[model samples]
Target: MKEFLGTLGQTTARAYGEDLIDFSRWFEESDGIELVAGLVTTLDLRDYLSHMLTVRGLKPSTINRRLAAIRAWLQWAKRKGAINDLPVFPRHLSEPKRAPKSLDRVEEARFLRSVAREGNVRDNAAIGLMLYAGLRVSEAVSTKPSDIEIGERKGKVIVRNGKGMKRREVPINADGRGMIGPWLAKANSDYLFPGSVGGHLSPRTIQELIKKYAYQAQLDPNSVTPHVLRHTFATKILRSGVDIVTVAALLGHSRIDTTAIYTQPSWRDLERAVDGREGGNGE
Candidate 1:
């Protein structure tokens, strides 16, 4: 099912595949296991949850994700008359909530300086592309010169296989072109940001570079990442009042809804917005 296939997009899918397959295998082995219809009951769902929690020792987030996948598959099946109903989702099976992450400007500036300090024009461009262009790590890694059109006034980075493997063109300005120029010339390839041997940089290496900066900056390793740098880029751009749609397009989001999450205010921004409200004061 496409629901099962969609998991491939997640970072943990490779590791989680065995567990998911095992779950399917176990379902087939169980008595009265009509895999499609009979298993749509709460009793059946709870029993599976118990198996995952007790036998597999899976986290709530992991369990919930698998459950969500199962639900999607069942929904698809039901629509096609292969099943009757959706399995009731366990209310208690919920992920631990946490705030989204980003870097402050000072820390970001230090990180940028470190990249530039490498004196590898490629490194400079890689970090610059993330920070200035607000690109996802994977997008930065997969960039090709052919995917980009560099001109004097309005340049563009064409993300061919973006988050959902969708393509879109992201317009840029002279500053972006200037930032990318040095790396583009030295590299001989269709790839704008080539990898270590030859291709775009690996996600692991980009992550390692971020770790290196976090250590050098004396900041918590959790506080920094290639994605966070991208978020920082969008955050800075949004704070500067570049519209959300613009940031969404620049971030290569397929939907403006996906990009709106980046516009969540920093504490400082939120406080200012709250304080500046003109609603009547309490007596």
Candidate 2:
């Protein structure tokens, strides 16, 4: 397991390690078997899947992630001659398709108002980048003052390290400029949002910050996250008739299909459509 994890990047290794640990615990507790790569059978994998779905009631995505980790480890073991023959892995469980969650107009207004009311310039600026410019939390934290360029009539935020290390420029409008300008003027560190230890603020800190203001705004803190803010930005932009190609670029998505998901009607939109239909409601 250590050798397998060593081949992966640090972040990926940490996640795969956690998944492997859970699988190891389950292997010991359920079947009284040590988690050796060669000794594991197809039945063991099936039983693990059954346990996750029926006993633990974990989401398909969660189950698949763990399964993927195990599959990768097994493949690695086979290459190193630790296992001679591979077990036939079960097909991954199908995950339900749902639109990514985003704040409604009311929720956005309430949340932003709450932040504006008491949040420091740093907080407001960080949140604004996600809500307006569609920055991922990591991208927002890693951003430097030099990455942002605000002109009299136009501006853009350059995300140097987006998902998959792909770089893209997100245009900033008046609202984004207003929120970010104050902080940029006052920022002293290389990071736009500096941490206590003198590096960028961790993504976890930004998530917690969103939760804090969500609670203050009388919204469910669990429902409000930095990703939700990014979703809100994407949804709003798509609804305003922005082209999918453009939106994909703004969100740093390599595929147009990823951006197309925002075009799917939200629950609220469906509800409004049904509510406004003529003569069908009385039936």
lDDT of 2 by residue, 93-140 (tens): 986555689999999999989999995899989998999999999999
Flag regions of model 1 displaced more than 4 Å: 1-99, 151-154, 196-198, 267-283
Consecutive 10-residue window with the lowest summed lDDT within model 1: 274-283
For model 2 the local lDDT of residue 7 reads 98
Report lDDT (CA) for all predictions.
Answer: 0.71, 0.92
Model 1, residue 281: C-alpha shift (Å):
22
TM-score of each: 0.58, 0.67
TM-score of candidate 2 against the unseen true structure:
0.67
Candidate 1 global CA lDDT score: 0.71
Q: Which candidate has the top score in TM-score?
A: 2
**Model 1: pairs clashing at backbone N, Cα or C within 3 Å:** 195-199
Summarize candidate 1's per-residue lDDT along 115-205 as a digit string, tens digits: 6666767666677677777778888888986766667776777778788887777766676677777777676785776665876668888
